[model samples]
Target: MHHRATTSRRTLLTVTAAAAAAAATGATASAHAGASGDRRLHGLISRMSLEEKVGQLFVMRVYGHSATAPDQADADANLKEIGVRTAAELIARYHVGGIIYFSWAHNTREPHQIADLSNGIQRAGLDRPTPVPLLISIDQEHGIVARIGEPATLMPGAMALGAAGSRSDARRAARIAGSELAAMGIRQNYAPVADVNVNPANPVIGVRSFGADPQAVAGLVAAQVRGYQAAGVAATAKHFPGHGDTETDSHYGLPRIGHTRAQWEALDAPPFRAAVAAGIDSIMTAHIVVPALDAAEDPATLSRPILTGILRERLGYDGVVVTDSLGMEGVRTKYGDDRVPVLALKAGCDQLLNPPDLALAWNAVLRAVRSGEISEARLDESILRILRLKAKLGLFRDPYVSHEGVDRAVGTRSHLAAADRIAERTTTLLLNDGGLLPLDRRERPNLLVVGADPASPSGTTGPPTATLATALTELGFTVAALSTGTAPSAARIDEAVAASAGKDAIVVGTYNVSATSTQRTLVSRLAATGVPVVTVAIRNPYDVARLGGQRATLATYSWTDVELRAAARVIAGRARPEGRLPVPVQRADDPTRVLYPVGYGLTY
Candidate 1:
């Protein structure tokens, strides 16, 4: 059952030579170097213990700004979860193959801090007995889910890029983000969300997905994959088999997709196929269940029929397959914590990401291997994929990155300018009634900016209202701001209405007005004030359909500062709104009635 015995020498040489060629020239390898590289990989695999091989399949998260010297809160969280005080200690204990960074976990504070943390983590892994390098990774999707925030270059999210309808822009954004991540010693990015948002009510992937059109989403996903890999970072096409049509968030519950095999092929399969064609380094499995693919109704993360039959055999994707975070309720609901990792591996996932209990999960897998529940060859197959990816990334040669290059590579003025340009292009002017916008700075000298500043997935609100106010102020207009909160109280709405008095114009930022009555009420009351009202849909463009009033409206698709500033520019006539709706917005009361069709936009 040894890998060397099972894998033909010819196949080994081919793989090793390809990896070497990729590292040396980023091209196909010459046959001369194949034997040495193959020998090295085979020798390493033969020498690896069962424990060491099992450890290679896990990607764990540790709470800390510094891997070696964790702060008190970080230390406590790490100790409680993994029985360790620092990332180094956790890695030493578990021999984890990768580490995922999170801002809430304090793993990414800033550019320099992230570089230091990544270097420290790498040192720990290299110091291990087997001397394997860790794959440092982050969400870094840029707009909403960015773990490494500004002064890291924040690009527009997938939907915004879709709105702008430029594949070149998508590629450039991914390359810029990937280069910055690579400069900080991070090798993998879980980004370019491949899910096509077909269902408008989908709570988790609203603005995260590229769009509802399968072909369009596929094109953008492919572009991002090439872009990230071009910059020496692995790009992950995520939530495989698609999580775009479900109402429930996989982080909370397992939603079932009712797509028949034919429907799924037409709607959800294109982006994944495009990603594979683009040579993506990995594909992350979703926790949602699709009965059409598997009769047992197992989540895609634990279904061999879906992962192996559909993704592996059907799609011909040979890269590593990573599962979505196992800590999520979706995966944990069916099985015990110990069994989830084993099930996922059996289902053909090569990497188990963010298992809530690492020790328990690791031990379970080790026991499964020893008990012959999982064959040695099966385990080795996954190990080979993981190790090959590490080698392809040049981690075997050198895993560490320079601290001096961090500042130069991240958030340069040129990168920031690119972000602004892209963000400006994504500002869709959905409504510009009777020349209400391009507000004359002299006529509308005083402006009031008020409404919901919804917090992003990272729990940082751009305080979008304040950001918009600041942007308007910079355009020679006196602006006052009030944050009515995502779900504004009655008192908050009244205060906003009272404050709108005597203002030359009112700009309201709305976040999902269909869901929040208070936000709709806030907009309605503000419109009653008779000041020319301009509504900006900061998160999703669907708010315009629910606002119940004819006014100047813009959809930025996100509440980030870059997006807010772009909205301001369009209002001041500094920049023309060029973005169209990427996805159709249906009327609030009627799903059949399309209020705004895809590619619909109004420009001055």
Candidate 2:
């Protein structure tokens, strides 16, 4: 969709304020910058060459100067030549439209490092005669997935919040996440994934989605949109139509879904509609194929029927539509190098995101324009929308947020407190035997904790661990910590269980990752002992479902410090279990079915 307004609110207000100031000298919106500001912004974007215009549509990856950057100096030089150096050079030479930060190249643990990198990028834009700040974005969807390393704020993933069964809780979580991103000067957040997580076997998007119930997911998606927008950050609802049904990861290969247009409209489009109604600034297309929607074999990124007929026409969403990384295997395998920019433009996408090769993509777009493959009108449309978004973010006229902004807002107690609050509300208990939980204070049953160190040495866990030993200790449970690395060995789980023998109750904590195997054998073995076993799925409840219902379960959906405390509170009866099942729990034997349907949760 093209932008309807080129005149920035800031510029218009500044001009008006300036005129008023000349008459009386008191500051007003018109006097802030005014008509002159609008002209400057417009003129600068208009004066760019076709090459620059093509460049403006290309968004690519830029690794920060942190530990993760490639170490070889020559390779670094090549990256710079490709416009990966300073933000100023990127705009001056390539005129690239935006950037997606991969990871910090060195010591990325400190929040200050991220702030510094963002500041430098913003400064580079200011160096231009007419500054148009880059559309800097990050993948900070909270929970198991986050790009920012330690010493950064991490919240539980969407699944946990969805389980909370409160829209306000989801909004609070988003607000905290957005505030953290905005404090660092980032304007775009590619998050609040609207995918309905119906398939338990889904390799991805389990914890990232709000939940499987259409109405529940829609409500939470709206809250997340409201939270990010309220804090001045652009929120994008992504993988349009849906990516939750597929068993394959688009990064690895293309996944095909048999859903017809009607099926998709009924099952997969509710959250997106809710998100758009809540005013999401952008929508990203998924790479999976729905033959019912588009049979041309093109993914949503290049499918006119999917991107235009469905998204734009049926949904009435006029916001900018961004493509999922063009570099992903889904598009690359079918279209090759030249078709990326060309097909996405034809599909109505306003931005070509995360192209594998920027220079190649630039030429591809330029060639398409010269050969009449893509009209000049199409180019103008995308740039106009990009410019409008920049103005809306107050980036076109003035791109600076003072160091005070960083100091006053980032990591503030208010935001941290909000995270903790959401964490407490989102934890859900999936099973209980003989009212074993909310243990009676008089009994003083011996307690045991059998998971890895859930704390980050700061006495807090993040978006990953839902319950920590220290948090359990605060609940008056005698806690002992056990370490579970990326994947635990069978002996490790057995040893931990053996140590807990003869205890009043057995609590087993396990984390789930897509590629890692779930310990069904270990869980079954423990349940066989019949010693009142309680399993805490500190990652995805789906992890426990793998055990075939042999053990009782609690679904935290994360193991973060805050979530850990929330889970412990639920266990000790300090808090009521309000969260419902966000996604269906499926058993391995019945791989094609669900063991626990959505909305199932136990309460005292």
Candidate 3:
């Protein structure tokens, strides 16, 4: 709707240098038409009021249905007048620049429902002063971090794709995932986790990362960026500097990385550099603290040395810098909810995401601006970066996507097949002693399948109908189902043991066994019986570390039904466990020696 000046020469070089670096790495940048729409972008920024410009720096979250009482009243009041809830109220009132879609917000099974909600939000943004379209973003990181579940394609996730051991797999995964997001009117993805999960005990980032190899992670990050952006969705390389080495979950508390500068450069920084080289649209800051980079104990999300000095200067990432969810305890605990947004902005983040209260955060930022704490010029810098990304997405031209083709485009047959391929590729076999795997279902069809219960899903997907038992049943195995809750209690373990008494073999599907003592105990209990026990880690790969006695141990890294089916095939000897270990698992007997080093996998 508005046009501005040509992009400065410095900006042009930033684009060219990124492209040149991609070419050197044998990766290609996404071919975006009208990339030179900066003139229009600048005009839009020039026309924006200071409040509007400041709003562009904060991206908040909104539920699809009214979750809270006040929000319900607001929606009902608006729905009465406009025949639809004015999603624009987020823009018209609070002036949040973007909105992150959670499963609750995009909860409907119908693709049209999700698309219509996105369109409504964007149309509302466009109707107000300056007429800028909102950035519809999601955690379509494909796998355990996915925000849009099925009917979207159920990707096997990062570790699975990484286990495939091919950049081609990474590229293809991102492309399919990105295309689906585009079909859903999602413009940005908080994905391509650049974190290298070096810690086996890491409960949060286990399967979210590609693998443990820094070089491989770098290559995969580049490949995924090319694929996702090429598919018309902006790909983010996140948890910058890195979140992989930390054991603490930032969602709950601050995790500090004590790596020296050199240590960080070696262990944590490679994938981020590679992502910048790949011309990634945005890089999400990690909430973890790197004492080597900034001695203040503040996270990269609130550190100038890390965000501006390291990422902006050393890494030459001139693109947008986005903060992780400001609402998380890692950030919120340090900086009060009202102050985190301003700190993130002052620290160099272009977007402050998921603040507790949008109005309070915006007012705080505005107050900082008025007090000369955050310069108006600096605020405009973030606005320009945000606008440039919006322009790259062509959000300015037309943000509304057609609902007619969305159902056909998202979660296509080809996408599902690609997901299956990756899942099969990433299904790693850590140990298969005594030739115990590929059990003949025809012979040992009387199997006890454990951990296939419908646990509360952490991601956006609705309660899954497909479980390990359901999948095993389809494979002609007489799977006796055991539905343990999120954690297997001692009673559940006893039940598993009793169930195993009559079964030919026990296939225990473990989740986060490293953290959940119940799961670890269940595995040890079953293995102690000396019965044929097979362990399959459906969430993280560290289960084998605790229950090394299992005759057959495997990891699928995610609970996507397709991946579960792939794991079943691997167990049945129909599909090979081609996936290698992405993160190292420590031996129970020896901490010095890794039980299974990275890239370890076995096949029948």
Candidate 4:
């Protein structure tokens, strides 16, 4: 994420001083290591033909048969062969500099699936003796976006970290996330999205961003970057410039940045700037278009003026520049005229990720170099950065990971325990009327839980009902779980209403954020009946805002196993809701603004 600075003079001075010190230290290391590691890296770059150097900058996917395609049965055999043969041959034949793993094929694989996958791909990269190791990257952003297989430590998304409002909390989350990926032999993470969540309606970046406040988001981004890099995983701050304001998802088509270039400079660029200053190792280009920045191009991914002119020149970002997945419609739909890899590289991207067509990408880059379209110098420029990144990652020394460290890294008991701490800290109480919470399990032993269904599925899990029932049961509350899908199914609502009618206190877990009509109506009905509706926002906090008159809401941010237990602790009066809303919660009529600003939360 190359962010143009909008900073105080004092901060600028501090940054300049830090940069100077880092340069001196880095020069010393490079001078000492140049003979061995640095010399080999330089030698390989010198010996590489233009084709090979260009290949080093291009990272493509191993495509499988389309899941939506019709001839599935026949395609299955071809897909497996495609996975092994395409992967194996890429190393032997193309010697592609890097490879990206798509999570589709290995959905059912075991916990160490990534370990095996990374090993295979790295073996392919090392088939030939390159002085430096090849780069491998994955999209292992936590929450709904995790790409690693089973026993994945699915923590709450960035929004949850925002909810915690603690730098230490975010740092710990990143450390665990980094450890998990590194344990799997994966070294790069396309994560810690620095985009400030300014637009609630943004489909692609809704919960992915930290929050709306630039300062808070910046702090969290910095913390996460340090944690991830400290753990030896290269953390990437993504969607450069910003992707937080658009309503459309760039995955489907080009999303234009309506903000003027200056407006973007002021609002969306702060966190990214903080990230770069924090030494985030890589920046992923967004698929969105900014006409102010690139009037001639629809998407920035294909625009050199934006990528090279602005991101490189104006911002002075020297890190590896990776493009968002090239398989997205944003690039494929518009730039179908030319091969994507060539356009991306010409646009100053150091890596072409998940290239839709590998042979096409390879030949296009090769063809560009042969035809003098892209200079050998430009190719070298990118490879230099790539090699530098590999060296910085310690990959140049030895890309191989120890086979002995498997038991302690991923999905271990300790990692799960850490996940629980993150989950516990992320719970927030958005609303509490007259201290109507902390359902004393000893006092209100016969507790009833209403509104636990797919309609209320937790954002942490991205499924139907939250685990409130299990959490309550664990707390020894005589609990009952019921779903109120769009409208409360008559039977379900009646049962909940009857059960809670005279209970000492009722804890209603309403999936208030974007709830289905039935779920919304059920919540309304329950609220009208005068039961203590401890409405749990298992998803977005805006869900509580949507329940305009329903002021008795609690936001757990997500329904991860960790969050569920934490929410129960809050209900049982064991833990306090020390969190605040990371984003503003607006009233229905005032969609443009928020009724309760970020950082508004109640105490027990």
Candidate 5:
């Protein structure tokens, strides 16, 4: 595997001071390896062509498992968009500095497969005329947002860690995740979401955020940054200036956060400041418009005032500034695909991520530089930062990882046990009325596990119900599982109610109950069967407020197998419900009233 060489304490201290100085001065200074490294980086930059430097700023996505040998489906998609049949061809043509992996894109299949893919891509990048190492990155934020699934040491997500209320847990989980990603030859993790989820109604960032409190979220963000970097992976604090309070999903629409200047500073800026203070390797810009920060309708990704003025000047974060996907509607609504990238570069972004049409965006950037819209000097600033990061990651020294290390490090028994312990700590019992939980195994031997088996952000489903049943069965209960879909039809609810009959106790997993009445109806119908019912909010804690009448309720914050099994253990009295609510759940009937305040939890 690509191991980080140990640095002496004296050298580490000097490097830290240098990095702080670089951030304050906004200079593209190489701090990790001192003056010699700086000379080498500058020498490399001076020798690169404008085309090669421009390519270094883009971290594009390609549809393929292998660099040269893509499946038919991946080949068709790659050719249609990138004008290339394989990742190798695409890299040779565009000379992209980085590539992102997504399970949906078939980029991540298994640990060994991912390691091979990483090696292949790195080889392709090394074969380029200028020969730069590719930064292989993925959004393995765990919980609902994990791209690499199964046997990958899946840990509880940000909110779940928030609920667990332990910085050490957050740090440990991130360290394990980072080490695993590094083992698979992935160098960057777009994780430890720093967005403080103050808005419970936020559709995209609800469970992904650490919590609602800015200071608390800031603490966890810093801890996670330390953890990921400690494991030799670049940690990214994302959706900058904060995407926590917004209601719209940037993937579909441009959401405006109406926080005033003072409100923005107090409510949204703490986590970012904390991240900067922790020396986070990179910060990803949000696509949302905050009128207080910038008067223009442009998203933060395209706003010089936000990206340059606020982040660079005010926050003093000199590390790389990467834009969220340019294909997202939030960034695209204000400008064409061609103009968006140029605007982002001018706005102080160092990397452009996943543009919809790579050829169009790449050509646009090239034209901008040639037409004097974007200065070559300006391009060098980003290139220097990108290269400095690559060097710090030890990518220039050795980008390829050993395939044998994949099995040794990706999913070890010790790592999985740590995940289980962390997941167990995150199971928060919102309500356990009349001591209905810790269902007597002897009395409630025959149980029905039914409810919304919601698909995760990765598009994988069934851990909610299927995994719950398996966990309960392992705990010696005779369990029957019925998956009541997230938006269960009335017929599905009827089938669930029928399945609940004659059962000793009914266990229902609710997913985002506030969004749909059908799940609420399903839980209600199951409860009406006159059997003792236990509800687990497998996605978000807000669901508990909507189903207040339920006798027993727990919040897992995610539906991953780790979380579901944790919840099952809590139900079986194998583990205590130690987690507290990370964010408050307000009453559905009255927005002004708080139903379950933050830090609230029940234990028997």
Candidate 6:
């Protein structure tokens, strides 16, 4: 977990590109020169025109598999809209200060390929007459919202780490995760979700958060920040003022957090305060509306009081105030794509992340600056914060990564082993009504593994992926497997139930059961078979509530291959279930009637 960071890809690119930059009279990555780096910052800002300065606030996305970002229409469509073809064009055209990569962008299996792509982006930024290396980043929040998967250590999620109940382990998990990004040349990580999942009915921030308790979430978030920052990656504590107590998904529509100022301070702001206290250099604003802080019905991402008054003045946090993706429906739809970026800047955000239309947003911000709607001083303040972060990251010294060391450094065996241990530790067995787990293979020798594959409706290609079925097989069981499609028909459930006929014991895996009634129904049907079953919620911990009359129930809170195998270990008795529930579990129809409250798990 304490592995040294590999050589930077930005450093490698610098040696080759510095000569050209020198010839053009532009500084290399090392633009900040002087004892205090003050003179250099002033010189750079002084030279920047209004357009260039405004451009520094936007952070554009470049997905891995696609030429256009995830939010964009298509490659040609993006070109027609923005007059830019690829990330390279977007960077040049807008002078984007940062680039965030999604799974589609950094989805390569090869570590070197990821490193090269990141290094290329940094090189592009450094080539201009006034050069500042890009803040290459990804939302690698492990578990649920992870971007870098497979080749990298798919570290157990924030809740899993909280379930493991060790701050040191939390730090270790984040460090392992950040090491991968650092090795791959991505210096900024938008992670350490600061939302405290107090509302059991909350849709989005469930397992992504640390826990239901404010104090515990604070400790966990602070620890993760330390771990990530120590590994030379800047960590951003996100969804500020809490995105936890909401029923709506910001990706789709507006979510209103209707807590009083006192309630908000008690439940949501504690974690954010702790994050800032721990020196979190960046905090991403949430899109949900915190009415107590701002009564205008504006989301936190565009609220002056929330971003500037609360986070900046009240909390006394001066680190970067980054807005959540501007493209999210929560804010983007409220103020058309072009207007959101400028509004975000005026609202006191330092970095505008993932604006839907890069050119339009850039032009809007530029216009705002030129028209004096956004002051020049305010522009400098935001860009200066960005430049200060780059300087702190030593991006000015050497911003690129070396491809040669990526294989050695990113997702090494040690990191993966640690991740596996963390996963195993967090695999919570909520129920074992009949000691049905640790299947006495000798007794339950004919093992039948079954579940609904998330991407198995016939046409999609999802990993042929590591399912609990494969995992049980690897544990030396005669695992006959049956996978129903995502939306299992009644017939399909009958078929699955039929498959469990001769099996001594059945292990059913549930994926995202909170939202999928089909998977929940399949579990109920399997229960009707009365095969002494054990249900594992592969994605949602709340799946137990969805399935009634289960012989036993377990929760892994993730579907990563490592977590699947970890669940296997727990089921096979190779490892004990050490995790406690991080969220409260209640009766299916009742939130007040708690069945298994926060910090509840069973082990033999």
Top model number, lDDT: 1
Error of 3 at 473 (Å): 1.7
| Residue pairs in candidate 5 whose N, alpha carbon or C atoms collide under 3 angstroms | none
Poorest lDDT segment (10 consecutive residues) of candidate 1: 1-10
TM-scores of the candidates are 0.95, 0.86, 0.89, 0.86, 0.94, 0.90
Model 5 lDDT, residue 157, Cα: 90
CA-lDDT, candidates in order: 0.87, 0.70, 0.76, 0.70, 0.86, 0.78
lDDT of 3 at 521: 78
lDDT per residue for candidate 1 within 306-421, as digits (tens), equals 99999999999988999999999999888899999999999999999999999999999999999999998899889878877888887766677786888788989999999999
Question: Which regions of candidate 2 fall more than 4 Å away from where they truly are?
Answer: 1-44, 66-88, 104-109, 149-152, 439-446, 451-467, 484-490, 512-518, 528-531, 548-551, 591-594
List runs of model 1 lying over 4 Å from the truth.
1-27, 30-39, 456-462
Candidate 4 lDDT, tens digit per residue, 1-604? 0121112222323323322232224544654444454444555588776656767876766532221221344245424533324455555566677766555544214445456556555555545434235677777766546665346666767888888888997888889878877776767889889898787778888777888988899899999999898888889998887888998898887888888878878878888888888888899999888888888965778889988888788888888999888878887777662467788888889988866656667778888888998888788888877876766765544455644545577767877777777766777887777777877778777766666554221223323243676677787887765555534677887777777766655555555346345666667777777655777776567777666445467777655556767788887777787778888887766787778888888886
Residue 297 of model 1: what lDDT? 92
Alpha carbon deviation, residue 249, candidate 2 (Å): 0.7
Error of 1 at 27 (Å): 6.0
Quote the lDDT for 344 in model 3.
85
Better model by lDDT: candidate 1 vs candidate 6: 1
- Write candidate 2's Cα lDDT for 177-283 as tens digits: 78777777677889989999877667778788888887888998899999987877889898897998888889888888877777788779999999988978889
Clashes of each: 0, 34, 3, 9, 0, 15
* C-alpha RMSD of candidate 6: 6.1
Off by over 4 Å in 4: 1-39, 49-51, 63-86, 129-132, 149-152, 450-466, 484-516, 548-551
Global lDDT of model 6:
0.78
User: lDDT: which is higher, 3 or 4?
Assistant: 3
